[model samples]
Target chain A: MSLAASQAAFQAWLQQADDAGIAPTLADPRGLSVYQNNYRVSLMACLSEAFPHTLAWLGAEAFEGAAARHVDAHPPRSFTLDAYPQGFVETLRAIW
Target chain B: MPSPHFGPHFGLGLRKPHYADFLGGDVAVDFVPVDFVPVDFVPVDFVEVISENFMVPGGRPRDILRRVRADYPVALHGVSLSVGSASGLDADYLRALRALVDDVEPAFVSDHLCWTRLGAFQSHDLLPLPYTAEALALVCAHVDAAQMALGRQMLIENPSSYVSFAEDEMTEWEFLGELVARTGCGLLLDVNNIHVSAHNHSFDPAAYLAAIPFDAVRQIHLAGHTARTIEGREMLIDTHDQPVPDPVWRLFAEAITRAPHAWTMIERDDNIPELAELLAELDIARDIAHQAAADHQVPA
Candidate 1:
């Protein structure tokens, strides 16, 4: 595939991975799995970084899972990973 | 102005895990460098530093930026500026950044040399850019524009990348050197990032530090990275989760030898420990930075 076409396909696969935009017709869905994992981990990483207290408050498994979900729902649109997540205390209360 | 250069001081990346610890006056961190919102907007500690995380306005985030700036030493770091892009500058982003900078009046400003926007679409991640001539011009122009907007010099940092571009024209060392020479901006040197990039791209860590114009370096960043050997090629992803590794410490020591008193910070975005633990690491950094300065200085 051309670079532009590949980029477009990749974008479609990425921005709407959850949606039914693209179907899985490759050798394996490992790349998509890795993408989702990285996305989840990155968001989780940012939340945990910004809110170490929350990690202590929620514990590792619960906090990581909760943060992973929260970030998936409300991912940062900006480019900088330094923009740590907020409103987690409330998010925790809302979910947990 | 601000300290004008980085110094051996202790600070904390304001985290929610220690919110009650801080609120109840249990943990005693000196400078609290806060995240985007939640931790920043509400009435938390007073001694806070604001990265570009708090740049975007409105909602709880912007409100927190104002609230935190009212009391603490707000330092702005822009991760989205994409300083190393060959495409062009994001004038709108710069204007928004200018507005935010004016509002916060931070202690210092900073951003990474990685690109986020390509052509028109901006990525949410700090995607790596080619270390080339086109990249250099785009970055210098963006930095110059950032300085113009904020009316003060900002700190540009090196990024850790998993991939390198094949169409590069110049080197990161030369690019950063020329950037400091042309822009008069400060360098937020991340020793861990240097280590990560060095391992990923087979370069002498000492040579990288020796290449930087130390005087232009204003702040330093130390963080933890996870190693992944991709396709038999070693790659260290700058995942700031755990403790600062040993080789990164070595690189940081070398970099500080060049710039003795740059504002030093440790970025831990995940699996954070208590304020006491983080502060302990910061204390260790201070000692090492001091030792580096003392050991490198010539008896004149």
Candidate 2:
């Protein structure tokens, strides 16, 4: 595959590892799970970082559930994780 | 007036919790409880702000940054440069970043060497790149484009990764060295990242440090990570949510020995402690750098 194609495949796999499955070209597909987990955990942590007060108020389990739903609905579009939770307060209110 | 070049300085990431302290305004000191008593102030040689946070047209963030810039030299650190993207550099992102640079007049600008964006989707993570001649050429071209657009040199940071590419023809250090040689970009060597990647990939952190061109290093980052046991193997994840660990501090001392003049900063994005606590950590960095300078016979 071309470089662009390879990068696209890699990103897709990271975003939806179980569904997309690992890249067919990868030598060790199991390692992709580590990257996939890191990707989700980091993004979730970014949301938690941005909405600390909300997390504290909602507690861990509820906050994690809300954050997961929010992330599923709105995967980050910007390069900065700081901006990932721009409308999260409203999202939390709507969901709650 | 142009900002004074404040030689090599120690700084901390100007986090929101400490915004009022630096910006000099009314903030609820009781808002967050801490072990250390809340103090009105602490002095830092410089401050590093996430470039994207202030890339807005006009708002409180810009206002606060302008006030802080008046007092402290700010360094613009970005996460979205995505220099390794195969689709090419984002023109619109470059334009906004350049405008912010002109507005802020930061002491320097830096971003990670890894790519974060792919086509219209941004992963928001510093994804690793394969070390190959083709990748090197592409990154150099993108760096040149970024520098030309911004009218200033940029610093590329090393990223922590969980996996290595089988197609890589060279080590990441070699890729960075070649990149600096080709594009005149500097390095923002993150000691914690070096330690994390070294552990995850089973490479010598010292060897990685030795391979880098010391003179090209313009800044250093120190941060903490989360450790986990995966498949009965210990993996260190660059979480940046806590204080710098002992091993990272050791690597940082070694890093200072090599690049004595590079500005160093502590980064904490989550689980942030009191500003005073971070300042204490920065003090450790200062002491270590001072000792390393003496040992290496480099004037501090």
Candidate 3:
């Protein structure tokens, strides 16, 4: 699969509430779901790491929700996930 | 020197919640407790380490350092050193880092060889730099200056990159060897990172391990990584959100045999489980090391 196609597939996988039709009998959807949650969790952590002042400004719950949504929309183009939420301040500005 | 608290000298990332427990409880971790002492917290171990978080001035950073430095060796793990960038080092930032190093009297200080900025734009991520001669020269100069300013050696850690640079020269390990030669700095080899970078870049993991000087390695970092096959091209992402994976465990086993006395630690930056959970993982690592040592006695 091309990079774009696979990226879209993962995007679709992430968008699905439970990844309904994926990951057959070998691994449960629960494992995939947990992995999905962690993908978001790690991105939020990067948000907190990069924008601690933003986190302090928005508070944890709201900041987390916004960060997850932001990542969902902007998916990282770079290989490194270190700055997944590097544009968060601007994203927060656009949203709030 | 063997850490008084821990017998074997391997530790896990001391997250915030467990800080109070670690400081209050009598038990200590590893021979050298490679842990972080966050801003606005009391001192815990014989050493108070910082994550370059509170390595600033006139704010909670300095205040926290003042309180923690009363006890413990202060080692700084910085995320912004960008020792692999072609744009050259940030002198101002380095100067501040040097000042902080002096104040802490840290046992050692380190940063990733990944560039976090392009020009004036700072992404705040430990982004990977191209493995080229230009990149190597820029990083070596910074390492040399950082060592001179701090009046001590600086250890450079490998970065986990998702994509390979279009322009490159030599392997990452070769660049590391060259840097050591040019600057006389040490290495904080991240085992999981070796696995991650090798997976992403499609290189021989064993070959990468063999290239670096084992003696120069002062520390080892083991963290979790996530894998997702994006359109058939698999990508392994380093996400320090869970327990160390099994593959990393195997790789870590190989590492300890080579760098036997190297100080190692598990890094969990998010979704941090209970201290018991981390300790349990640490217990596994300890057990593996013991078994490995025991096997050597049988004469392989």
Maximum-DockQ candidate: 2
Query: Tens digits of per-residue lDDT for model 1 on A1-96?
Result: 222333344445544575232223232233243344455566677788788887997789998888866765564555456554756666778886
Question: Over the stretch A1-96, how does candidate 3's per-residue lDDT look in tens digits?
Answer: 222232233335554543433333111223344345545665667778788887898899988888877876675543245446667767888889
Model 2, A6-76: lDDT tens digits are 78778777765542523465533445666777678877888897788988988999999998887777767
Model 3 Cα lDDT, one tens digit per residue, B1-300: 232223335665555556444444322343113563333433222332445565556674465555445544455788766665445566777778877876766666888887654434344455445566766777888788778877878889888876554456678999999998888888888888899878877788889888988767777787898887754567777778778888889888877776666667778877887666776787777777677667665221
lDDT of 3 at B29: 41
lDDT of 2 at B144: 96
RMSD of 3: 9.8
Chain B TM-score of candidate number 3: 0.83
- Per-candidate clashes, comma-separated: 14, 0, 8
Tens-place lDDT per residue, model 2, B103-172, is 9998889999888888878887787787888889999999999999999999999999877777788999
Interface RMSD of structure candidate 2 (Å): 2.2
DockQ (model 3, Cα): 0.06
lDDT score for candidate 3 against the true structure: 0.65
Rank order (by DockQ, best first): 2, 1, 3
Judge the docking of candidate 3 as incorrect, acceptable, medium or high. incorrect
Better of 1 and 2 by lDDT: 2
Instruction: In angstroms, give how far residue B60 of model 2 lies from its true place.
Output: 1.0
- Return the lDDT, model 2, position B152: 92
Could you tell me the lDDT of residue B245 within candidate 1? 81
Instruction: Judge the docking of candidate 2 as incorrect, acceptable, medium or high.
Output: medium
